[model samples]
Target: MAVAVAVAALTLVPLAYVLVSVVAVGPAEAARLLWRPRVGELLRNTVGLTVAGCVASAVIGTGAAWLVERTTLPGRRLWTMLMAAPLAVPAFVNSYGWVSVTSAVEGFAGAVLITTLSYFPLVYLPVAAVLRGMDPAFEDMSRALGNGPWRTFFRVVLPQLRPAVLGGTMLVGLHLLAEFGALQSLRFPTFTTAIYDQFESTFNGPAATMLAGVLVLSCLLLLVAELRFVGRARVARVGAGVARAAVPHPLGSALPVTVLGMAALAVLALGVPLGSLAYWLVVGSSTAFPLGMLAAATATSIGLGAAGAVATCVLAVPVAWLSLRRPGLVSRVLERSTYIAGSLPGVVVALSLVTLSIAYLPTVYQTTALLVAAYAVLFMPRAMVSLRSALAQVPPEFDDTARVLGARPAGVLWRVTLPLVVRGLGAGAALVFLAVVTELTATLLLAPIGTTTLATEFWSNTYGLAYGAAAPYALLMIVISAPAAYLLTRESRRTVPGR
Candidate 1:
């Protein structure tokens, strides 16, 4: 119980500090800031990009998932891996690739394109999982009743896919809200970019906090809407019946067109960015790699990522256990609280921490602890989601069985529940660790004066047009993040039922 409380406290402190400092300036100041032209523009851009990105991701992700999971498409297994591999390529990397290919691709359109490419996988993974798990009986019955492929897909499969689609869409939306590097690189202005600008140009913590408060409120409203509209139903298949795969509808003359289109998208999203990175690496190698600087940045990134991952996983365990086993208003609230902080842009969280630190804990200001706190706030949801999935697999009956055998609650948790869920916990930690390694906006703002991570190093070198110098850091980030991405994809595939 004490451990749980401490984890919860750790997760909440940064958020609380941010909120209190924002509100400390009072409502009038916040209101005045909201009325400013800059705020209005930021709001418009943020909402527009989020809406556009979410819609595009849903369409693309769902389509890809359907093709890979339900179709008799050739190379299905390979396609599944290719579909998800884009997640390893960060949004900024994708943006850099696109920009390298064409100078014109560096605005709103570029932001949408890069973000969609990077994020659509979020939707694809879950949708594919749910589709794979779906019993084909419904579709088989529909066909027998004379419904065409399109009609059956709409009337039968899609309705059943609502929960998964919505869940994936929610993840995409949250990511869009928090997105920074891609948007900044694409020369788009959103609340996140505005917050970063305010932080960078002038250390206006109160104003930045004010904007962050509004950003949080905006995210809360979206969360409420998603919960209300998306519903709270599980989409898993029940029973031990052998569910056959859905019959793949032949595209006939359209097959060539469909295949080509999908292939082109995959190439554009995954291939182009990678090609650009390779080019830069080759060019940069001519000038020699900055071995020492690279080593220091790599070490710093790994250390912080490891620390944040462990911290986030530890904090997420209690929240997951509470929500699953001791679920109630409080548990639910605690669970949702993490999301509130998680969904905000890293800039917002970083600035909020900066404000609180400068005013109250100046001693720890610009320290690693403060940076890790920002990471915990920004990436906790990934840990929570993985933990929740792990907890779900550990049946409540197992706990009851342990109690019946005379084991105490703590002992049962340690000996039975913990063992069962530790894999999931480790997977969750890996997810957070990878995310932290590539994280940019927050690290830029919160990292100590001399501290450098791969992300900051890449950003600096790239901004200065030192493509060769930037290549090594970018390469290192990709290499470090690759294993984690693979683990996540493997775990997701294994746990996702049929597919």
Candidate 2:
């Protein structure tokens, strides 16, 4: 418990840095910067994009999950994988694909389109899993009560899906709030992009810090909203009856339409970016792939990702254990505190670390260790969520069994609980690793001066208007994220929390 609290504090370094920096600037300076017309525009854009993106994602994700899970869409299994598989594609890569094909996706519409396509999987996977495991008894009862499918769905199905819906929506909001790469590429000036622009153009000036403080405030607002919407609702079953399987809804005359819709969505979300990468890979005129530099960047990204994955999983253990084993105010606070830093853009986290390190730990500034720490902090929630799911699956009987066999608590954890949750640990670690590898803002700001990563290299090449040169790195990122995303989909089917 103490360990979890300490880790939570460590994860909050970004928030602490922002608070201290903003306070040091004095209210007059903050008002001068954040109270301006430009600040208001940024806020409007940020809030608008977040709300619109979440709505679109909720609709698309929930719709896709329902179709795949409830309807007799042919090859629903394959379609299910296709729908969720977009998780592997980074939003920036999706933007690069669309822009490479056509420049029409600019400003608000483009930002929402690309983000919804990229992040809807955040909603889809969980909802689909819940739909898969959902008990049919309730729906049957609704039918017996003479409620039509539509009415039953709206009143019964949707209400029961609240936990998954709200959880997924919260993820969408957070991703949109923290999103940098996609928004930047799409030319939407959210708080995150503005903060990055300020830091890049001004080099850690007070203006950048002030902008970041506002972004942090935005993140805090998001956390508060999530807490209210996703309160501690009980979703567990009270009885021991085996759950009946859901009856698949027949498509009938809608079969061709269902197939077309599913095909179009899959092609748009998964096919376009992959097709774009392949096109740039083989046919571009400026195709001067830097094999050696690509290799070096890949090596750096993998090293940092692997290290960050381990560190994040280690930090998540106590928090997840306490949340599951000793559920209470402290555990929930420790668990929830990790979400704030994660929702701020990587630039905010990176700049916060940059300020903290330069002010008090200059020697560690720009070090690989510092970069990994930032990754762990930013993605700790991913690890903790997966860890808690894994922990929940490890029944108490195993612990009791081991203890009765004269095993110590530590022995029970290692010998029994660990074995049961090894898959979940892998799931959590893989998620953190993939997130770290694709991570841009923190790595860009906190990495060692000479270090280059796939994300950074891709950004550099693209920044220089060399799309062909950046293709390999983008392709490599998708390749790495593919299995991790698949692992996550598999893990989502486990003994997840209620609904």
Candidate 3:
């Protein structure tokens, strides 16, 4: 209970600080700011880009997942790897890569393109997992009834895919709402960039807080809508039976077209960014690889990532256990509260913490503790989802058996549950670590003075048009993130029996 309280307090402090500071400005002042033309314009752009990006990602991601998992596409294994690989490229890096290739890629179109490319993998990964696990009986039955392939897919398969598709779409929407790097790079005005500008240029805490308040409100509305759209359906299977494998749909005459389209998307999304990185590395001078800065940034990134991952997993455990095991309104609300914080832009979370620290916790202001708190808030949901899935796999009968054998609840958990879910916990930690390592907006606002992580170092060099200097940091980030990505992929594969 003390551990849970401490975790909640740490998570809530930054949030409370932001809300209290923003509301302190009075309703009238906040209302007046909301009525401004600039605010309206920013709101419009933010909403527009979010909608556009989410729609594009859903279409592309779902299509890719379907093709690779269900269709007779050439190089299915290679395609699956390529589809998920974009996650390794940071949105900012992809933005810069696109802009480097063509001047035209620097506005609304570019914002949508970069964000879609960077985020589609979120949708693809989960949807593909679901497709792999789905019982193909429904589709087979539809086909046996003389329905065409398209009709069978839409009527039989699409309905069952709702949970995975909606889950992926929610992730994409939340990400788009909080997106900063790609939108900023594309010269698009969004609440995140505006809040960031206020902090960087004028150091106006009140203004930034006000913007964050609005962003949070928007996220709340989206969350409610997502819950409704996703429904309360469970995707897990019931009973014991051997589920037959899905028969791959034959491409027939459309094979050439299908292969060509997939190849083009792979080239645009994966090939382009990787090629750009390689190009910069080759053309850039040898001096760009500064051993000292690289070493420092690498050490800082690993330490912060490890700390944040462990902290987030610890914080998430109580909430996940409560929601999954306890199961009630309070637990549900607590679980949802973390998602709200997670969905808000990273800058908002950072700025809120900054304001709170200055006003109330002055000593901890700008400290590594505050920075880690920010990471925990932003990435806790990643830990929760992985942990929840892992916990579900451990049967309640195991605990019952242990209790019958003279073990207490704590002993049962420690002796049995903990060992069973350690891999899941590790998977969750890996996700949080990867997210923290690549995080930019929150780190920019909250990192300790004179402490530069690889993300910050890369952003600093890239913003100054020193691509050469940025290359090494970007490469290091990619290297650090690669192992986590592999772990996630491996765990995902293991989720499918006999994979």
Candidate 4:
């Protein structure tokens, strides 16, 4: 209980910063700053991007999942892996690639496009898993009742997809709300970019914190909508008969068309960025490939990514355990509070840490420990979700039985529960590692003096119009994150007909 309470308190640091900053100036001043025209403009851009990205991601992700999981598309595993490859390419990199090819991608359209490409995987992975695991009995019944393919999909499959889709969309919205590098690179100002701008300016005080507070409110609205929209789903089959794979809908007449569509998606999602990188590597005459610098950056990125993953997962376990094992209002609130960090941009979290560290823990300022703690606080929800899912599958009965058989709590955790959820722990770590390596804004601010990761190097080089020089680091970031992306794919593919 103490541990969980401590974790929640730590996670609320950003919120605390906002609250403290607001109170310092009094409520009327806070209200005036928030009501400014600039604030209104930022809200429009942020909300527009969020809605557009969510819609596009929904369409693309669900369509791709249906094609790979339900249709008779050859190379199902290969297609799934290819579609997920975009997740390895951060949205900022995608913008870099697109802008390098043509200078036209520099506005709202660009932000939506890049974010959808980068985030559709969030929607794809979950919906795919649900579909893969779906007893197919429901779908089969609809088809047997004389409904056509389109009707069956709309009436039967889509309703069942609602909960998973809502959860995935919620995640995508949260990430989009906190996005910085992509929108900043695209020259599209949203609340997140404005928040960063305020912080970077000479008088970054109440205004930046105010923007963060509004962003946090936006996140809370999303959370409430998700709870209401995805309320109380009973997503389990009740039958003695075993579940099996739904018969693949034969793409008899549309085989060539399906292949072409898949090819188009693959080209747009994976090939374009990769081809651009290859161009810079081989053909760009001005490209300055700094081999030694790239290597050092790669090493630093891996170290930080690995450390963040492990640390985030370790911090997340107690939170997940309380939410799952203890299961009460306190645990639930703590879990939700940790999730608030998800809605905060890295800059907000970093600035909050800066304020707290300078005033309190000055000794640890700008240290590796401080940076890692920031990573844990910012990305803990990813680990928490994975761990919670894993824990949910471990029936409480198993723990009870182990305890009754002369085992203590620690022994049961070490012997039974931990072993069962070990894969989940690994998955959680992989998720955080992938996120940390591609992370830009927070890393830029909180990293110790002279510390440079692949992301920072890429951003710096690209920002200076050294696109060719940035190519190597960008490519390497994608390469390093590919294995983690594949792990996520395999994890999502666990739609065993019978769990």
Candidate 5:
């Protein structure tokens, strides 16, 4: 419980900083900053992109999952890998790919397309997992009552899928809110980009923090809306028998079209960025691989990713344990608090840490420890979500049995509890590692002197319009992330007795 509280308090630092900083800016000054036409335009752009991106991702992800898991789409396993492959490419890198190919993809439309391609996997993975485990009994019952396929899906399967869909879309929305690199590359102006501009271009801490406060409010609204939609309704399986695998729905005459659609999705999501990177490598004027720099960046990114993943997952364990084991208002609040920092833009979190560190703990300022803490604060929710799900699946009776057999709490956790949720630990660690590897804005602000990760290296070159030089870093990020993406695909797969 104490550990959970400490973790929650650490995660709350950025939010606390934003609020305190905003208050320090007089209300009248804050109002003046927020009420202008520019602020309104940014709000509109941010909200528009976030809404469009989340909806498009949900549709694409959910549809693809249905094809892979519920329908007789050929090469289900291959398609699963292809669908999840986009995740290996960071959103900024995706935007860079498109922008490099043609100037056409440069505004709202492009932003939506790039982000949707990058983040839809968040939806697809969970939804696919649910579909794999979903009992076909309900669908069969609905069919026996003479309901049509679409109708049955809408009424029965879709409702059961509500939780996954909502969770996926909510994550999409938050990512969109905090998205900076992709949006900036596409030349879109949103709160995140605006805040970055305020900080970097103007060095106006008060103004930047004020903008952060608004962004935080937007995140809160999103969370509230998701909770409201989720409500108290139980989406879990009600009665227990041997849960059987859902039969694949036949596409019949639509097979070609379905196959073509999935192919297009794969090409758009994976092909374009990868191909663009290849193109730059082969033909771009500035293309050159400095193996020394490349090796150093790759090693740094891997090391930082490993460190951040381990730290984030370690912090997540206590919070998830308390939430599942205790289940009360305090535990709920602590768990939820960990999520708040995640919704803040990486720049906001980074800047807050910079301020807090410089003022109170100058000794740790700009240290790798500070950067890892920032990673933990920014990505804690990823670890928490996985851990909570994993922890929930393990019955407390096992812990009781272990305790009864003379195992102490520490022994029980080490021997019994941790072993049971080891898969979750791996999943959570992979997720945090992925985020840490791709993180840019926070890395830009928080990385210690002389440290260069792939994300930062890529961003520096791209920011300078050296697409060719950036390609190696981008490609390396994709390569490093591939195994983790494959792991995610495997995690989403639940074994059915046969095919």
Candidate 6:
């Protein structure tokens, strides 16, 4: 509990900074700053993009999962891999690809389309995992009651998928709220992009923090909506009956159409970015690869990503364990608090860390440790969510039995608990590593002097419209992220048919 509280305190630093900054600005001044036509315009753009993106991603992701997991689609295995390959490509990199290809993919429509393609995998993976493991008895019962196939799915299967769907959509919404690179490149003016502009263009801390304050409120609203929709209902198996393999629904005449649709999704999500990278390498006049610089940046990105992933997951274990084992108000609040930092834009989190470090700990300012701490603050929720799910599946009886055998607390954790939850740890670490590898705003602001990460390098080249020079960094990021994405795919294939 003490460890969890400390972790929560660390995670809450960014929120505290926002509140303190807003208070320092005084209420009237804050109101005056926020009450403007510009703020209203930004609010409209941010809210519209978030809502539309989440809905579109949910629809596409859920539909794709159902097709791959439940129907007799051709090449289910291949489709599973292709659906998740988008995660290997960052949203910003994906936008870079689209922009390089055509100018038409800009503004609100383009933002929605690009983000949905990038993030729908967030929804698809979890929903597919649920679909793979879910017992089909509920469907059988619904069918016996005379419901048609679609009706049975809506009334029976969809309800069971609520937790996974809600979890996924909430992630998409929060990600959209904090998205910076893709939105900026796509010419969309959202809160994140506006906040970055305010800070960079004017160096006005109060104005930027005030914008962040509003963004935090939006994050709170999203959390509330997700919580209310999720409720406290349990969605697990009730008895000890082992789940049987789900029978795939035959597509018959629709098989070819389903295959074509999957192919189209793959083309949009994976092909565009890759093809654009190859094109830029061949034809862009400014395209040049400096091997020495590229090697240094790759090493730095991997080093930082690995360090940040380790630190974040280590901090997450206690919080996740407490929340599951205690199941009380304090634990719940601590766990939920971690998500607030993650929902904030990377600029907000980075600025907060910068302020605290400069004022309170000058020695640590502009250091690798500070940067790693920032990564933990921004991405701890990813680890927490994965750890909590993993810990939930582990029976407490195992711990008790170990204790009865004369094992100490540390012994049980290291000897028994760790082995059982190792996969969860890996999954959480991989998720954090992937985020850190692609993180741009935070790395740009917080990284130590002389440290250049792949994300920062990619952003610099792309910002100058040197697509050819940027292509290599973007491609390396995708390559580095591929192993993590594959691990996630392998982890989700628990009950996939024919596996």
CA lDDT scores, all candidates in order: 0.77, 0.80, 0.78, 0.84, 0.87, 0.87
Candidate 6 structure, TM-score to reference: 0.95
Q: Order the candidates by TM-score, highest first — what do you get?
A: 6, 5, 4, 2, 3, 1
lDDT of 2: 0.80
Q: Top model by TM-score, which number?
A: 6
Q: Which stretches of candidate 4 lie over 4 Å from their true place?
A: 142-156, 236-242, 392-412, 495-498
The TM-score, computed over Cα atoms with residue i paired to residue i, of candidate 1 is 0.88
Per-candidate TM equals 0.88, 0.91, 0.90, 0.93, 0.94, 0.95
lDDT of 5 by residue, 1-499 (tens): 8898999999999999999988889989999888889988988999999999999999999999999999988898999999988889999999999998898988889889999999999889878877886778889999999999999999999987776788778878888999999989999999999899988888988878878898889888887787678554443343446577678889999999999999999999989999999999998888889999999999999999999999999999989888777778899889878888887899889988998999999999989999999999999877877776566556677778999999997788789888877776887788788999999999988999999999999999999999999999999999999988888888888532111
Stretches of candidate 3 exceeding 4 Å from the true structure: 1-9, 142-148, 285-287, 355-363, 388-427, 496-499
Candidate 1 residue pairs that clash? 284-468
Best by lDDT: 6
Model 5 clashing-pair count: 0
Off by over 4 Å in 2: 238-242, 358-363, 388-424, 492-499
Q: Model 6: per-residue lDDT, tens digit, 1-499?
A: 8998999999999999999999999989999999999999999999999999999999999999999999989788888899989998999999999999998999999999999999998888878877987889889889999999999999989977776787788888888999999999999998899889988898888888888999889888887787678665545453565678788999999888888888999999999989999999889888888999999999999999999999999999888887776788898889888889887899889888988999999999999999999999998877876676567556677778999999997788789877777776887888889999999999999998899988999999999999999988998999999999888787667642211
Which model is ahead, 5 or 6, in terms of TM-score? Answer: 6
Q: Write the per-residue lDDT of candidate 4 for residues 1-499, one digit (tens) a residue.
A: 7888898999999988887887897889888888888988999999999999988898889998999999899999998898878889988888888888987889999888888888998788767877787777787788889998899889988877876677678778888999998888899999899988887775577788888888989988887787678654445554566677788989999989988998898888788788888888888766776788988999999999999999898888878887777877888888778888888999989888998999999999999988998999888877876776567545577778898999987788779888777877877788789899998888999999999999999999888888888888999999899999999889777753223
For each candidate in turn, give its C-alpha RMSD to the true structure in angstroms.
3.2, 2.8, 3.0, 2.4, 2.5, 2.4
Ranking 1 against 2 by TM-score, winner: 2
Backbone N/Cα/C clashes per model: 1, 0, 0, 0, 0, 0
Ranking of predictions according to lDDT: 6, 5, 4, 2, 3, 1
**Model 1 lDDT tens row, 72-182:** 677777777778778778888788777766878777787888898998977787677667657789898999999998999999989777756765777778888888788
Candidate 2 lDDT tens digits, 284-357: 77677677987898888888889999999988877777776677878878888887888777877887787788
* Candidate 2 TM-score, true structure as reference: 0.91
